[model samples]
Target: MSTYLTILGYNSAIPTVNASPTAQFLDMEERAFLIDCGEGTQVQLRKAKVRFSKINHIFISHLHGDHCFGLPGLIASFRLLGRDTALNVYGPKGIKEMMETIFRLTETHKGFEVIYHELKSKSSEKIYEDSRIEVFTIPLDHRIYCNGYLFREKPKERHLNMKEISKYPEIQTCDYHHIKSGRDFELSDGYVLKNSILTTDPTDPISYAFCSDTRYWEEVIPLIENVDVLYHESTFLHDLKEMADHTGHTTALEAARIARKANVGKLILGHFSNRYSDLSVFTDEAREVFPNTFLPKALEAVKIG
Candidate 1:
């Protein structure tokens, strides 16, 4: 199984030639999830060559315009493309009302069913799960009700050792599954074959956390601790700490601090303010605290091991 994260937009509030608002695509275990649908998200998706139909779930961190303004247009575009599969949109409360109002006023009828999951929990909670992945919400401190998301891959089954199994002709094809499940195999001679000899341990499950549009919230540290990748909002430099706090945003230094405290594998800084033309300053300041920090380019995919 492979996991990747593509940053579609990374600007804060205002969209510029080099950056857009908050939007990303998380591809894990062959499933695609859209995180935050800011303005021009659809256009970015096309530029990134993402198959829009593969994305069935859209998660909005908050109700802010920079975080969710592109949802209506994306939904309408889906309808125009003749999408009939059910679409699930998860966000804070009032999201459904806001989208419904827009659709009703525009007389836009969706070809697919749009299901909304309203999030109001202030504590970390599991919101979505499947055979391969589980999604949890990390309550964030923002001006509005905002929640970050933790994407965790489920533990995989042990890999079958084909060479070892080939040596035992009595081990039928149907028995491979049992062997992979850690079951002992019995031969016709009544000899017991240990599962450890037939299969190897699977790779460790990986997790990714997406934190955006929030202040320096320490509560998120425990929820996202030890994640493979942590994509946190760094809207300003440490020099503008007061402004960042007043606006309920995190500075690059603050984001790096949280990443270090949480002991995450890699830290990705994004959601940059338009005031700064040179992003190297943010990287320099963050690397001072967390050396493993990274600044992702738009439409660039980062592989998660």
Candidate 2:
């Protein structure tokens, strides 16, 4: 199964010549999930070559314009494309009212069902789940009712040893299911073969945590501990830490510190302030604390094991 993250836009607050707002596309096991539908997100999606019809679910971190402004436009575009599949949108409370107001004012009618899942809990909770992955809400310490998302791959089934299965002519193709399910096999003579002898251990599950538009919040460490990849917002550098704290946003140093504390495998810093023309400074500052930090470019896809 293929799993990766496509960063469409990473800028904070507004769109600029060099940067846009917060938007991302996560491809997990071929399933598409839109993270934050910032302004011009649909354009970014087109630039990323993402199929609009594949994105059935969208997770909005907050009601900020930079974070969710493109949602209505994207939904309307979906209707224009003649999409029939139901779309599920997960976001904080008041999102339904906000979207409904936009639809009412624009007189736009959706040809497909749009399901809104409102999030209100302060604690961590599972908001979405499928056969292969699960998404949870990470309560953030932002000025508004913001949230982060944690995407975790479910435990995979063990791999079947084809050579071992071929050794027994009696083992039919249908019985491979039982072997992959970690069940022992019995022969006509009552001889039993252990499941371990027929199958190899499955690969470890992977996890990705998305933390944006928040302050230096340490309470989330336990929930995101040891994740495979962590995309944390570094809205400012350490030099502007005072402003970061006042605005309820994290600096590059603070984001790196959280990654170090959480012991995540990789740390991706984004949601940069447009004031700084050069973004390498953010990477330089973050690397001072966490050496595994990375500053991803727009449309870059980072592979996760």
For all predicted structures, in order, the TM-scores are 0.96, 0.97
Write down the lDDT of every candidate, Cα atoms only: 0.94, 0.93
lDDT tens digits, residue span 1-305, model 1: 68989999999999898788999999999999999999999999999999889999999999999999999999999999989999999999999999999999999999789999999989889999999899999999999899999999988889999999999999999887788778989999999988899999989998999998899999999999999999999999999999999999999999999999999999999999888989999999999999999998899888997
Report the C-alpha lDDT of model 2 over 43-159, residue by residue, as the tens digit.
Answer: 999988999999999999999899999999999999999999999999999999999999999999999999999999999999988899999999999999999999999988899
Q: Over 4 Å off in model 1, which ranges?
A: none
Q: Which stretches of candidate 2 lie over 4 Å from their true place?
A: none
Error of 1 at 38 (Å): 0.4
Best by lDDT: 1
